[model samples]
Target: MRKLLAATLGILSAVGGFVDVGDLVAASQAGARFGMAHSWVLLLGVVAICAYAEMAGRIAAVTGRAVFDLIRERLGARVALLNLVASYVVTVVTLAAELGGVALAVRLATGVPYLIWVPVAGAAVWLVLWRMRFPVMERVFGLAGLALVVFAVALFWLPTDWAALGHSAVSGGQAGQGWGAYWFVAVALFASTVSPYEVFFFSSGGVEERWGTADLADARFSVLVGFPIGGFLALALIATATVVLRPAGLTVTGLEQVAHPVVLAFGGLGLAIAALAFFAVTFGAALETGLSAAYAAAQYFGWQWGKRVSPREATRFHTVLLVSVLLGVLLLLTAIDPVALTEYMLIISAVALPLTYLPILVVANDRTYLGDRVNGPWLNTLAAALLLVILAASIVAIPLAIGTRMGQ
Candidate 1:
């Protein structure tokens, strides 16, 4: 029971990474435009993230270090600092996007404007980080995020064409959206699923919880079970959109449109449930991204970090967390469209994926870190293949964005 509870960190990280604002829009857009053709991308991303997260968890449990810490050691401070700069920028932008998501979810639930909720959301997220017990925080949000299962449930209630959905999953096409747009959405959804912050939060949460070799099985169990569940929820979002939005020619311009199918099927009750799920996942992601931003900086500098210590003890880390949330709030105050921000966030995250992932692959195989616990042959094979796909996504992300004019 204790071990099972510890998996909350994995669940929180996966739910945040797999279905935050980015996935909510990207996955639905894929479905709205291309049916279930992009389902394979989500599946591949789940496999990739699971394999790497298992390695990251193993490293943290055995070595008492997170991925960013290993990067500084293996790649030298100069290169790692550069890596940190890129990662920090991407993460802060991601933090901003999540804050916007939280506000949007609030606006969906209440009649108040989303801008009014931005700072409130940021303050609330910071408060939770400032005072909550780490595991308690993880479990609360992870459990709440399961409210997204409403999407899957709503699917069953709706008159879904199961055979057609399965056929589209097996036989992918551009659905008249053009291969360029199709692949662009594919890359974005894939990037969201394997977002770097997921691993950062996952491994850092393990370290914060003081995982050891004895906890390795529990960590692995978390990634294997938690992430796929996240992927399933995301797939349900896609399936719902395919069934309800595609034929209507709706393109999911915001969170409200994402909830349309459920609202149509179950009316007001469904809208309320969708809003709760949206708030939980986005607020949970805001927490993860804020921590991930600080985690990257603290781990890079070898500073004292983790919520296990007093705020005064880890002042620099906590300061970064506070500042990151403030920055996010400020970004949202500029009144940028949260959906558009998420689209941009996904593209940039795609470009930065290799910087975050390559070092993990290298260090996971290093006996210096894990000794006999290093990645086994099959894991290495999968990690290497996934790295190639990540690289392809990174190499092409900007060009595709430019060429397709952000997948017009």
Candidate 2:
């Protein structure tokens, strides 16, 4: 029972990352623009994140330390500091994007402008982070996020061409969108799939839950089951978009378009469910990113951290969390389009991907940490190949964005 319950950690982490606001838009955009051509990217990202997150969870369980804690020691202070700065920036921006998502979700429901809900969403997220029991928070939002399954169900109800979808996945062409735009979308989706904060939150959450060697099996279970579910949900979003929006020549300007297929299939109920799903996932992710930003800072500096400790005891960590939420709120108040912000966040995350992932790969192999529990040859080889892909994404993300005008 405990093991099953513990799976919430993985589910929440995956739910938060895979279906977060940025991913919601990015995946939809990919499908709308390029059909299912980006399916391989999602698959590759799931494999990469699962392999690394398992390493991270194992490290946390075995060493009683978060990944950031060991990163400074293993990678040197200078490199770790740089990584910390980049990751922290990306995470906070992501938090802002998520808070924006929460507001957008509310707006979708209430017919209110999303801007009015920005501060409200920010406050709600901060309050949950400040007071909610960690496990309760994880379970509540993780389960709620599964509401996105409506998209998959809609595929059957809609006039979806499964054979065409399969051909798009297998053929893997540009769909006349041009190679640059396709790869731009590819990098953004990849970044969203393997966002650094997901690992930060997952490993830190493991340490907070006091995972030990005995809990290793549960940790592995979380990684294996959680991330792939995220990928599957994301694929469903892509499939729906491919079926509905692509045929109509519509692009995902907002969540409304993303929910269009569901709405067509189920009408009012579909819209309601999609809005609820959006809110839960975004709010859930807001919590993860906020805590992750604080975790990265606290772990990097060796300060006290984690929800197990009271806010008074972990004042710096709590302060960072509060500040991050506020920043996210303020950013959204500027009326910057949430989807645009998410796109920019993905570009930055793609560039900084190597910094967040490379260290985990290095430390996972270190005898000082995992000993015999270190990655086997097969996992290491897979991780290495994935890292090369990450590096390629990082190198090309900016050029592709510039050349394609952010996938214009």
Candidate 3:
């Protein structure tokens, strides 16, 4: 039972990452316009994330250290700090999007304006981080996030043309949308699927729980099970959107629009499940991005972090946490639509993918860190190929965004 519980924590963390606000919008947008052709992006992303996250978990279990800590040691403090600044900024922007997602979910549930729920959501997120037992928080949000399976269920409930969806997944083309727009959605969906903070939080959580070599098997199992399930759920989001929203030619502008497809299939009850699913995933992920932002800062600087210690003991870490969340709140106060900020963050995420991933690939082979446990030949080959694809995506994200006006 204890093992099952621990595995659930890892899966929950992955699930939390898989269906956050950015993904909820991005996946739906991709599906509504491009159909299931972007499904491969999620598959690619899940593979890449699983590969590196396992490396990270191995490092944590073997060394009792987090990825960012090794980043500074390997990449030098100056470079890691610079990476820290960029990663921290991007992560906080993500947090703001998630906070906005939570607020939007609340509004959908209660009919209150999302703006009115923003501060309430922020405060509630902060309170949980400050006061909740870490494990309890993980379980509550993780289990609730499973409610998102309704999206997959809704796929069956609706009049889905299964063979058509399968054909789209297999045929893999832009259809009516230009290839530029198609790939743009692909990049955004991939970025959202394997966003950097998920790795930072996952490996750090392993370290926090003091995972050892014995725990490594459990860790790998969780990633294998959790991430693919998460990816499957994301695909269902797209499939649901393709079925309901694409016919209407609706563009996704918020969580509400993302939920519209489900609402069409299931009515108000579907709306309720979708709202709760969004809220739980975003709420859970807000915790991750918030912690991950701080974790990177602390690990880079070699300051102690994790909820096992008091805030005073990890003052620098807690300060970074407080500051990151505040920055997210301030960003929203500027009155930027939260959904739009998510789009920008996804682009920025595309740019930074190599920065975050290169370090993992490098460290995974460090004999000093892993000894004989370093990546074998096949894994390295796969990792290198994926790395090239990520760099290509990073290089092209801006050009495509400009050429297409962010996929107009």
Cα lDDT tens digits, model 3, 1-408, are: 988877877777667666688789899999888888888898898898888888888989998889889888888978988898888888998989988888888988999888887778778877877778977787678788888889888888888899988998889688777988988888899889889998899889899999999898998998888888888888889998888888788889888888887788799999999999988999989988999999999988888898999899999999888888888887887888888888988999999888788998999899998988899999999999999989999999999889888887
lDDT of 2 by residue, 186-245 (tens): 999999999998889889988998889998987788778878988899999999999999
Task: Tell me how far the alpha carbon of residue 246 in candidate 2 is from the true structure, in angstroms, after superposition.
Answer: 0.5
- Kindly indicate the candidate among 1 and 2 with the higher lDDT: 2
Query: Which has the greatest lDDT?
Result: 2
Per-model TM-score, in order, reads: 0.97, 0.98, 0.97
Return the clash pairs for model 2, or none. Answer: none
- Please list the C-alpha lDDT of all candidates, in the order they appear: 0.89, 0.90, 0.87
Instruction: Name model 1 segments beyond 4 Å from true.
Output: 1-17
Model 2: number of backbone collisions? 0
CA shift of 277, model 2, Å: 0.4
